[model samples]
Target: MDSITQLHATTPEKLTEAILDGVRKEINDLKKEFQPKEPDEFLTRKDTAELLKISLVCLHDWCNKGIIKPYKLGNRTYFSRKELVDNVFNSNL
Candidate 1:
């Protein structure tokens, strides 16, 4: 069952303000409930190579030649899946 309530406003401006306030509350609630996805997915060197269908040697070479970018943490390297897909789509070949 649903219950309806009436909103009373003295002036048009007050009515507009009340409506805007309700909208703002709804927007705030949505914002609170929203869960944002990760901006980019990180991949390991081997995973990245496998995804690109390239061998480890070739992947390393591409990284060395600046064809593919790599991020290093400690002794490990990572690549952005989004960046790799973008490159594949944008490449001439």
Candidate 2:
């Protein structure tokens, strides 16, 4: 009666392909949902300072002293969020 009905009635192969395509898309979406999210790899100097509840100067000193691993991209400096958190937790004990 309708084009959709005509298509399904005339072409079972096409219908199967369409169904498989939809299933594939759904599977991919489910995979994405189930996948573990990556932790933040780098944090800006300001963000790191605020996160640690310290001043930028002290953060810089720590960075220089290797208390926190710092990465420099262009003129901007970044710190590893994981390392900072680890250092704080490890130091508390």
Best by TM-score: 1
How far off is residue 16 in model 2, in Å? 35
lDDT of 1: 0.88
lDDT of 2 by residue, 51-92 (tens): 888999998888778778888899999888887777864795
Q: After superposition, how far is residue 83 of candidate 2 from its true place, in Å?
A: 1.4
lDDT of 1 at 69: 93
Enumerate clash totals for all models, in the order shown: 0, 0
What local lDDT does model 2 show for residue 76?
Answer: 90
User: How does candidate 1 fare on TM-score?
Assistant: 0.57
- List TM-scores for all candidates, in order: 0.57, 0.54
Question: Clashing residue pairs in candidate 2, if any?
Answer: none
Span of ten consecutive residues with least summed lDDT in model 2: 1-10
- Cα error, residue 48 of model 1, in Å, equals 0.6
